[model samples]
Target: MKKEGCCLYYSRKSPMDDVPEEMTPIWSCTNEKCNGWMRDNFVLSVQPRCGQCDSLMEKSERLLPVLTNTSPNQKKN
Candidate 1:
């Protein structure tokens, strides 16, 4: 059996080698004790609250897969 988390299980290369990545907007919890965050585009609110900590959130960015909003209510611009 190949180790997974404890060890990297790769075929030829890392699975994320060819995937695209970008600086995506996200909301991070202000409470240092909590590791809570969510993608900014996933929520419609101007200022979103942390769902895990229920604390105020701040805008931030993360290197994540390029995603597009699929919400039917989302307006095209």
Candidate 2:
């Protein structure tokens, strides 16, 4: 029997962790009216068109800026 504070665990697997080696993500499209964007499996030969506007698409890398917390005194008010 397992103790109140101690227990045994078993190894588990998920389908999401089984991404094929050749799987590659390619940008589908981005809505100009909104910030919505999407990607599809290129190597997997899945949906190759934009799900939003059915527009032709290409692979792209999205970049996000990093923000650092500043001290209260450092903030200009």
Candidate 3:
């Protein structure tokens, strides 16, 4: 018979594991406590606001995957 261990351990996979990413332009919330950010290209307005805290966001950079355009006419040069 084997004895069981008393310690409880857990391991979680990182969300970014195996995903290709690059430093891209983004907007981060100005609020110090907020960790909200958004891709610059995805925002509809010239000035963007944080979706999480409703605060003004500032220009920033983040490591993210290159998003592809679905339009056939939008081929990259």
Winner by TM-score: 1
Q: lDDT: which candidate is best?
A: 1
Local accuracy of candidate 1 as per-residue lDDT tens digits, 1-77: 98767767668765786879999989899999999998877876787788997899998899998889898855423
Residue 63's lDDT in candidate 1? 97
| Per-residue lDDT of 55 in model 1 | 97
Question: Worst ten-residue run, lDDT, model 2?
Answer: 38-47
Cα TM-score per model? 0.71, 0.30, 0.61
lDDT of 2 by residue, 35-67 (tens): 334434222334345656766556665532223
The superposed Cα distance between candidate 1 and the true structure at residue 6, in angstroms, equals 24
Score residue 38 of candidate 3 by CA lDDT: 80
Cand. 2 TM to true fold: 0.30
In order, candidate lDDTs are 0.84, 0.46, 0.81
Comparing 1 with 3 on TM-score, the higher-scoring candidate is 1
Winner by lDDT between candidate 2 and candidate 1: 1
Q: What's the residue-level lDDT of 74 in candidate 3? A: 39
In candidate 3, where is summed lDDT lowest over 10 consecutive residues?
68-77
- Pairs that collide in candidate 1 are none
